[model samples]
Target: MNGASLATGQRSLGDPSVTFPLWPPQLRGCPETSTAEIAYPVEVDYAYEDVDTALFAQAPGPDLARWAPLLPPLHAPTLGEGGTPLLELDGLPGVYLKDESRNPTWSHKDRLNRVTVSAAVGAGAPGVVVASSGNHGASAAAYAARAGLPAIVLASAEAPPAVQSFVRAYGAKVLTMPAEDRWPLMRRIKVLTMPAEDRWPLMRRIVDRFGYHPVSNLTVTHTGHPFGAEGYKTIAYELFAQLGRVPAAVFTPTGYAEMLYGVWKGFAELRRLGVAETAPPMYACEPAVGAPHARALATGTPAAIVELGPTGAYGIACTVGGHRGVRAVRDSGGEAVPVTDDELRAAQELLARQGLWQELSGAAGLAGYRRLGREFDGPVVCVGTSSGFKDLETGRERVRLLEDVDVDVSLDDLLRATDA
Candidate 1:
């Protein structure tokens, strides 16, 4: 009864057509400026709602027309990008697979990229630059393309072969640099790249603001697009509609920590709005080879600083920890778990048995869950972040094929073998 009504065709809360506020109140707090080197303005906010308001009742995208007046003037009606499936695993008891691979880019990174690109467009950046080894780069590239903005992806040549192909497939300028130099170069580009004053930043914006085409800013990071994370909130909403109760835990594979943050934030908001009775503990799963976020959580450090090492799960091979990672684990009283290559492979096989084909990195959440399942009770959802196709770059699946094989298939032979 409290949901935003699409039938009225009236724009209200958080809609550009309305007038109160642009961002949801939760994102209104200033971003932690504790570190001067990477200080960036916090651009998201939310409204004050009671714990029982049932936040899911309001579907942002479909309700955009109703809430348009309450958001930024530049904000427009959005696609329903957040609603996704939470499929149960046949072989694993109490385990569910949140298939984020179904997103626009075939990965959970779409949740972050959609919002991040919107930020670039809103800020009027000429171009966007990103330092990524896999999913993030592809997500950024595709969204940049969708916005009709120029994008530059600074990736390590050592990245998995499939990810390299994904970056190029999106028409993003793939700059191959040494692994050590990628991040630094991304920072340099951020400082040097700026759009012309007249640039529109996106095709839609160009048509809305001026007739001139816009350049894409290569500096956009973080899913600060208020409406973008709105896509992610759908995960929680669907969970509620499906289970009729909240889950006990939600495990996510971490890189930029956007997926974890998005799900955690969604449940938290739902709990706050009285849509859900409780929030699930959000667990972050990382590859052991470079799990700075996990180490940081264990050490009680604000952010962990360590050198990233190579791992088969390239998507989550992150070193530096993000602020959202800290918030995600802390808010839900959750823990960060690290899994090894062997564990990821095993989990991938387990998922295969359940008829789910996930990339090695995508299976890391299940791997961590398997390792820590004993400690957690009740229903748990592990995010399958991407499809196996993204693992093509490693070239680790070389197999020898036999041109011909001598074999017999007959009922008598099968009976004899069984008897033997």
Candidate 2:
């Protein structure tokens, strides 16, 4: 079992004393979430004292199973996730880019789905369901298919066509609805009015009726699968080994802040095991269009729901924030960074020049770092979450133009035509 028994129990982030056994798989959110304004996420606790420091020694590779004991019971089949590269860029001094687009589904969500799907398998659940605009849904679909189970993706109709096709290609049931309606339907709270009745049924009563385990959030706020965030801890472990020490700062793209919290937890675990003395401060990067985490942090609230604005970077443009993010920031003495679409596009372009084609939202770490506009004491790390191919622009029908730009014209005219 690779010492999997070291995982002691699960506890609520709001009230750590509210705990439960990890065995039978706590796939559901905090059942004690009583208030509408304050839905808390639960987290996994481990016997870190029992863990041997020698196990921290790792080589470069794309397999998270090696850290199986540090992670949740990974009953789901592997799709070659984790162990992404930590690269240095020219413009940002002492900052390394931890590119996660290398995963099976070309997104960091692969790490999360690996554990979430396994929870489904461990629990003997029928299948899995999730609500995502892009990467999360695709990763869930791929993992579910690998586990020989069906998946239902409650995606936004506004989601890029390529992402829509990517999810369906995995044989998942794709139900595209208005972005706002997806969450309420998952909670089975209330359905919203839409243009068509067809999209309505796609989001309703998935868990209660179909008996499918929800791999995404169903709480009033964004308390996703407890095991999912644990998957992201692998990133921190990989970073420590790659850099030869813990960094002074780490920037992460944040929608629900699961990844932000997970990264912090991994480093915290290292401190607990005495492998490292300190955990780096995590910076949660969210689109200014709707930075709920940043808003909550400013107001001294655990989490908040913000009035959202439109932006091209949809992946990290979340409305509801989670308490885990708050805990991570507060515990680590970190702060939230809100990024604008202009900054996201600029960051994407910058990384692309560095031969890293991160998606608009994927470049959020750089955007946040740039927004901060300063250098750190020690090495800094900025996480790149997804590929540029996952961008909405990649789905548009402009690729056909590349077949022939009519190079018959003069060199000057050709350069002008191609916008070179």
Candidate 3:
């Protein structure tokens, strides 16, 4: 593999005093700090150089590893995860959709898993572990399989049947359990586990003993995976190349807002390198049930945990907000908009009418844009995060069979029956 110009170390978001090496992926909570709830987001430094602006016009390949200069060393195999299409709606002028459902796993999580599972391979771990509601597990399992590693998926019993089946089909050992029980067992097993609350300390222990790499949050508040978000940066690169410039705004369906942060970072990098004059504003759209990012922005905190109520947009219903998300919103002068399930459903139907079948949660960005009811100075992009097939409602329709036509029916009779 061609080596990346990865810098020596990383700095913490909560405290600059807490720094660590880029290798052996660091935790989200700072050990030197007293408050574990304060998310310590680590940033990987790279030796970025100014490249020719004309290079942006080149088409990006399906594999994100082709952009290795901007990413960490990757060891996992690719399944054509990136290079999703940017499409425009017929009726919605100055609005484009970044169709993430075109990915291998039919979700944006494929980008994250591509990099995170590679961390497991880089660490020489025997297997990978993840605690997910649905899509994350399915993507992680597929990537782990591609890396020739065993995958253990600890998913919520409430996860959709289709998502569960996807994980199992990827040859990952799946355990359906309550959300609270997933982390403890994963840490004990010393596998590379996903982010969760009440498990950071134990994860630190497992990392120390078994050298298991973690690619998700480790703090009470979400800080996000350092390298995993790098995969999402490709979306911005593709958009910039496709649009010939940055759009005025980008609306994303937000959970922990990893993709939101990563997209913003990519645009910022382009501006820094003189590829673009400015970065677009980022809008984070979340289910109104929780919306921790909205709460944090309103309360003016780096991170916040909010009590969640039930909502149909489960994919974006995160209880905690990440500091990276807050930074992205603030730096870009953007807003976090809370959307209702009703609005998301309407957006889903609208997209479906346009021949784009997206998950309800994946349509949150469109819902937010409609809720805003304002026009942008330039083109706006809404990221459709996943396929409609991943939603639980996908296969629930009942098909009614018409009475069978007689084999001996004449052509006139068939025509008469059709006319009737």
Best by TM-score: 2
Mark the 10 consecutive residues where model 3 has the least summed lDDT. 190-199
Tens-digit lDDT track of model 2 for 74-100: 888899998898999886779889999
Q: Lowest-lDDT window of 10 residues in candidate 2?
A: 189-198
User: Scored by Cα lDDT, where does model 2 land?
Assistant: 0.84
Cα lDDT, model 1, residue 364? 84
Best by lDDT: 2
Model 1: per-residue Cα lDDT over 286-322, one tens digit each: 8888787777777876556567666778777765565
lDDT (Cα, tens digit) per residue for candidate 3, span 1-420: 224535456667667667778776764545565266666577666666533445465686588866766776778889889889999977998899999999999999999889888878887887776667677888888998898888766655567878878888989876653335655665465323233343445444445565555555556788666677778888999999888889999999999999999999889988987889999999999999999999999999888899999898878888888888998999999999999999999999999999999999999999999988878999999999999988867788776543799989999877776652
| Residue 100 displacement (Å), model 2 | 0.4
Better of 1 and 3 by lDDT: 3
TM-score for candidate 3: 0.88
Evaluated against the true structure, the overall lDDT of model 1 is 0.60
TM-scores across all candidates?
0.72, 0.91, 0.88
- Candidate 3 lDDT: 0.80
Model-by-model lDDT, in order? 0.60, 0.84, 0.80
What residue runs in model 2 are displaced by over 4 Å at the alpha carbon?
A: 1-5, 177-204, 397-413
